[model samples]
Target chain A: MENRTAREYYENYLKTTHRLGRILTASVLILLLAAPYVIGIYLKAMPNIPAVLKAFLGVGIVYLVSGIVEYLIYVPMLGAGGSYLAFITGNLINMKIPCAINARDIVGVKSGTPENEIIATLSIATSSLVTIIVLALGVLLMIPLQPVLQSPALQPAFENVVPALFGAMACKYYRADRKAALIVLTVMTLLFVFVPSLIGSTSMMVIPSGALAIGLSYLSFRKKQKTSEGGNEA
Target chain B: MELLAELNSPVMYLICGGIILFVSVICIVFAVRAYRAGRQLGIDESKMKRVITASTTFAVLPSIGILLGVIALSGSLGTPWPWLRLSVIGALHYETQVAEAASEAAGIGGLSIANMTPEAFATIAFLMSLCIMWGMVLVIFNGEAYSRRLVSPSHPEKGGKKKKSGMSGFGDTAMTAMFIGLVSAYIASYIGTIVSGNGMFSFQGSWLPLAVAVTSAAAMGVFIYIKNRTGADWVDSFSVAGSMLTAMAAAIFFGRLIG
Candidate 1:
């Protein structure tokens, strides 16, 4: 995508991707709602409307603010078709986003290119397919595999899997701009330590941490530029 | 058939299986499109193939976790809805919490198949789906604008190329920051409990999660070494998964030994 000509090629294809992405996303929602509808139809039971509202309000309200924030934070990083796929497939922060970043790193493409767009989409789509296949197999094999999946020997690992994952991952990007990564990491860590309850609200915290990282990285960028300019002058 | 006994019944499998199949079809369709786009954009053919392999490998471990989520919820909600939910963006963290909240609101005694009347179960499903759509709706309507604005400052013009920024590009920096922020939040949560003396592992002196993290990071170092020394292209594919699996194993051993 960095090749200027490649971007022009994107212009040729963007329309179809965008239209399909939108329609697919809309259909996913309808199909998702259809789950409950079908269940209700089969059982001859419609949901209690007031109860639905109450539960929705109770569950949905807290998530509403965070959901919007997640959308804003993730969409740009992922790009057009990738966002649609990742959002519909879910597991953005935990799985899809990291998978995308890793794929880009391995393939040596940076963001903001048509190539990057393609890479992100490809990796996420790969991830989604793998997830579905693996899960479906697990569901079918549930009785036989339950012991392995839930083995006490592996329970501890599953419990702390998130931390293990990010520990391996967070080092890659932050190392590029150590100062920024450190600053954001320290601030966020301390904030969470003192306010432990904030752990549940990850979506909201992304904004402030992202703001600080960008702000600090800008300073480092300026210094690096100044040195380069000085070398040129010399 | 009594609804309770049918919680894990064939009908439920058909419904859930249909959703998974649909998601898979969409995923493959887009994957092909992305491949074509990659070729047009001049990405190396081999590199694109490697990306698919790497992503699939990386996805393996997490998919196991997600499967566990479906299994966990199936005991109560039956396999279908949980399968449908987890298959499509319904995370364990969110699915369990929201489902429980809705079940409680519907006055189910607990999150149990026995306690779930069809009506209560319907409410849970509807409310859960209804709530989760906030991000989806935004993506459909305004995703392009939001994403465009994120990178627009660098572009400045519709047809122009990006200016080389002296600083870290906003795209990379913003993403890095968010990642650091998110992981920090997770780590901090564990530490917070420890500092407050509320952490279960602390009394036992294991620092279970931290140990797991360090072990995983170390395992990643090993993976990195394997990648570098062997020049195994596949090593990069397994780095994250290997790190996670090894750490998990270490967590169990360390937890039991010390605690």
Candidate 2:
């Protein structure tokens, strides 16, 4: 009887903490979502809001927008609840939006408490908002000094940063289909290198051309398959 | 000499091209992987349908966006970009350029629209701009498609209970979250322009600001990296980087036209 009572008390305590975390997460998500409009209205109302506040507000707005975008575009297209949950949680955690409950932890909480549904959703949204705001803030704070960055000597190194970052990211997702990956990479490189000169710009054609190449390869595969089937029958 | 210096920035083109290439390669790699996965699943002709749907949707939209951008750029350079309605977008874009130039001429910390006509600015509001920015952000964020479906089996012999609640519905929540995120980012950009007392096209003039911009751009990637512990974390980072590259590229393209 004493052991039963102790177990009940512990369960109650866990439930209470879980509920509290949910509430906090939900509130933060709502605030992050509302932040853009709040800041927009505030800026419009009191134009004299200090530069630092304005900067933070600007950052907050970015986070808010990012949250909205993730909610709207991906959630609808993905259709699966687990996938959606993963996306929300992944976005929150990856975006580095700090929430009391780590996004990955929410997946584990489902077995113990049914309350994780709200916690997972809210925490994911909150984290995404936080990360987006920081990104915007970083850029907002950086734009006033373009001329110095563009100096002839500094240009080469500064320009390498974006591509280098992209390269690091790309290497992380190498395709299992080595041949297909190599073909795509080669075609994309040629487009990036040659098409810009041919079209006198690099902005648009690389993607379409690469896509067309992929399409043609698929067609060839289909034809080969059909030929093999015929040979087998004959 | 000053005008020539502005025009001759070759690094600008290199940066722009490299970013585009990065985006292209990322998209292509994913498309190829997706195709292989579909084939491996051996869903018969259904796999072909998925491929067709994905290729048309993912590959087409960005190509159109880029084509529009190239045409706009050509117009900026006073060269014909050889596309449909080239003149119309070119002219509207030119007006956009003029407005930017006029705003720039007004000078930093100069006459903001609020300062010149406070009442009119208050009355107009940024609802329209907000709507437009939201739309573009939506388009950019939603371009890549990742979806799954569970159809009831065709054979009566393989009967099973009909799915009452289709797909966990987490995708809807994700879409809503992403929309909110992009909208927040858009709002941030707008507010940043106001706070910085500069137009959206303003460039980073020094290493400090450049470093800041680069870090900010990477922040989105870092966020995604942390969220995805395994299995395609790279795509998340690429998406973030892609969005930033798009913004930066758009700003430069506008600056050239306007400045």
Best by TM-score: 1
Using Cα atoms, each model's DockQ against the true complex is 0.61, 0.02
Q: Encode model 1's per-residue lDDT on A17-51: one tens digit a residue.
A: 77888898999988888888898888788877798
Candidate 2 residue-wise lDDT, B1-259, digit = tens: 3222222234332332333233233223323433343233332334233223322322222223223333333322211111111111111222232223322332323213333322222111122122113322322233222211222122112122343233222222222232222222222222233323232234322223233334444554554566575655334323433434443444354344434
Q: Which stretches of candidate 2 lie over 4 Å from their true place?
A: A1-127, A133-161, A192-203, A206-210, A213-234, B1-259
CAPRI class of candidate 1 = medium
Q: Cα lDDT for residue B76, model 2?
A: 28
Best by lDDT: 1
Question: Which sections of candidate 1 miss by over 4 Å?
Answer: A1-6, A202-204, A226-234, B150-168, B197-206, B226-233
Give TM per candidate.
Answer: 0.91, 0.30
lDDT of 1 by residue, B1-259 (tens): 2665576778878887887788889999999998988787677899999999889888998888888888889888887778889889677779888888888888995688777898888888888888888888999998766655544332345523445454335566556666766666555555655554343333422267767777877888888888889898778877888888888778889768864
